[model samples]
Target: MGNTYRRVLLKLSGEALMGDLSYGIDPAVVDAICAEIKDVVNTGVEVAVVVGGGNIFRGIKGAAAGMDRATADYIGMIATVMNAMTLQDSLERKGVQTRVLTAIEMQEVAEPYIRRRAIRHLEKGRVVIFGAGSGNPFFTTDTTAALRAAEISAEVVFKATKVDGIYDADPKVNPDARRFQTLTYSYALEKDLRVMDGTAIALCKDNNIPIMVFNLAVEGNIRRALMGEPIGTLVGGSCGIS
Candidate 1:
């Protein structure tokens, strides 16, 4: 718990912000996550969050139909901005210093995605939330998360999920699916593990940033992950899964 990660990229799925509600943003869930972030920020851990847009807009649903791919993706990016604004407001209301940086610029509300600016903000103990999903199409928030992690030079990418860790199969669907405490990148690939998409995994592996997939739905899991605890599936190069 002592300085294992000076900086971390926490990836939260849009679904995580849904909380007990049905759609859009849930203030309770956002506040809970911010509380966890504040706990680690007090520990001097620099936090950069990459948030998803599914809670408000699912681009895939539109792209799957006759919708133009770029247009759908643009809508998805806008959704991320809404989520960022919600989180930013909640964190600020909690007395936590926060910044919202978007890939697609919306200067009236937040700063543009400038790596140096982001690092500077982090140095000043401001939690940075990255929105807008890489400002392009044909890319999921997962891919954006990897890209930002590498850019921010985060030691680890914590992918907050519904499950505590990776399993050999869908544990929810398959009761016998074994949960792996750790896994090797090769095994994850050789076995076709669905922990992450191939593109996201490849980026993390290529950049040597270990990905910790843990269940954020569980109380305090985010803090545990930031503390570098062995609470999730750790995927990285040579280190395998842990």
Candidate 2:
């Protein structure tokens, strides 16, 4: 397959980094993912990544458990930063040029998030990893991905998840759930498909950035998605649900 998009934002859930473990990142898994990223970079596609902190912590869950909402979110943001560092290290070890840019401004560990700098890094063939969730408490890494994708003029958002694509219902719970090859933003929002947070989906819709949700668990899926191999569901624009 040929590369259909020049630049793309990859959204990875932290839980995917856990691999077969119950918590924390798996070294082998991170290395494997970095290898895929290396392949994608070698193909001349500019890639920016936004990783979630769900494996380490969930802000909403913490808030529900009696922590202050803002504080919980801030904690979650830090977790994302940790994940970003781990990913950056793994990529660098694979001999792939990578940079970890954080919203929280921890200069000693990472560079602060700057739109121009990030785009420049991409132009220089460096993978830019955005961390710390917009540097705000209420927002999620998903929103960060959408915002960064727009600012960087990315062609699409590759949402890497455990499942292969968007389903009419939870596939794990319902064996008969149907997967959609393509879907409209309005339909997803109207049906509450949960492909992404409403805010994140709205941002992508407003910016006309198509989102491709695919399973990260499958080998070579990242490279396939980036190369437009049609491995998952495409959402946004006039693509009708199926």
Candidate 3:
């Protein structure tokens, strides 16, 4: 497979690390993901990952349970840092150079996020994992991925979801749901598609960053995406497919 994007931001949901389990990180699953990332890196593609904390904690859920929104979100951010460290360890075990960068200051665990420093890490063939979800209460990791992609001038954001691509409805719930090969940002917003949150999608739209939503459950899909295979739904380009 030929490499298409020079640099790409991969958005991995925290739940994806759960594998067959219902909660927390699964070691086998983490190893598999790191293997995929290693393959992508070996192909000469610069990779930056933004991981979510939904598996460990959901800020909205906590807020609904009477916790302060800001405090719940901070807990969620810390969860992401934990996930990032786990992923970094797995990647390093596979001989891939990795760095964990957190938006919130955690000097003992990770480097404080700096745009130029992150770019430098990528230049040196190090995989940079961005944790902590933009270091804010309201922003989701999806928005963080979009922001970092723009900052690093990534060619695209590969959002690894359980579903193979973006559909009109949830495929798991609606068997008849139709999947789109391509979509415009306006169409996605108008249809209220859950491809990504509104804030995240809007950020990509404003930055002209294309997003490819694909299934992480499918083995080797990450490498396929890095090679520019037509494996998932591509959003925001001149061509629009409804």
Candidate 4:
């Protein structure tokens, strides 16, 4: 079988699972993602996921109201746990084996984050979902995705975004903006693209892991991107798409 990625770290924003709705989890949308993930698994790729909690709780929202950033971050982490549980339920109900590992020590609820254990689970064909966003303040889940992808030596960091790929400008705001089929990290930064936060980009660069930005809402996009099809912008060391 042709495989572009043997192992991948899927960075799913909570908002993606919300579909077109304004907030909270959307069952149909989440199911679609689970289906896509399962299809990828059938292709012999080991998947690890890092899901963000922006749909339920964004730390910045609390910080804007003078709440302590650290406290707000912890709240965000807990929200991620909720999302993880929901995802685990969705996947298992569909007959897939899954595990939710949290960064915080919640012995009764989920497994504590351990690099080797997580990797072993992936090697055994189990879907490992990582939540809780680094278990600390002053960091975003995007950074957590990069760190985890590197820790497990994932071939690519798949960022499931709302847009099809990284654009020179926000396609929604700018009708004339163009989507890049491939990109270099330096060019993305030089052009001031905002596909990911600065810290996340830094982590990927430091680890030499490429980031593939694609719209998760787009049907079959995830599987197509995983097979190395031309579906999104690939950015990082030696993307080989110049």
lDDT of 3 by residue, 93-187 (tens): 99999999999999999999999999999999999999998999988999999999999999899999998999988788999999999999889
Instruction: Show model 3 residue runs off by greater than 4 Å.
Output: none
Worst 10 residues of 2 by lDDT: 1-10
**What TM-score would each prediction reach against the true structure?**
0.96, 0.98, 0.98, 0.96
**Prediction 4 TM-score vs. true:** 0.96
> Which residue pairs collide in model 1, if any?
182-241, 182-242, 183-240, 183-241, 183-242, 184-240, 184-241
Model 1 gets an lDDT of 0.88
In the range 1-242, model 4's lDDT, one tens digit per residue, is 39888999999997887888899999988888888888888888999999999899999899998999999999999998888888888888887789999999898989999999999999999899998989988899999999999899998999999888988777889999888887877777666688788888878888888999988877998899888887878898665334
For candidate 3, what's the RMSD?
Answer: 0.8
- Give each prediction's root-mean-square deviation over alpha carbons: 1.3, 0.8, 0.8, 1.4
List the lowest-lDDT window of 10 residues for candidate 4.
233-242
Report the error of model 3 at residue 226, Å: 1.1
Q: Comparing candidate 1 with candidate 4, which one achieves the higher lDDT?
A: 1
Lowest-scoring 10 consecutive residues by lDDT in candidate 1? 233-242
lDDT of 2 by residue, 104-187 (tens): 999999999999999999999999999998999899888999999999999999999889999999999999999999999999
Runs of candidate 2 exceeding 4 Å displacement: none
lDDT of 3: 0.94
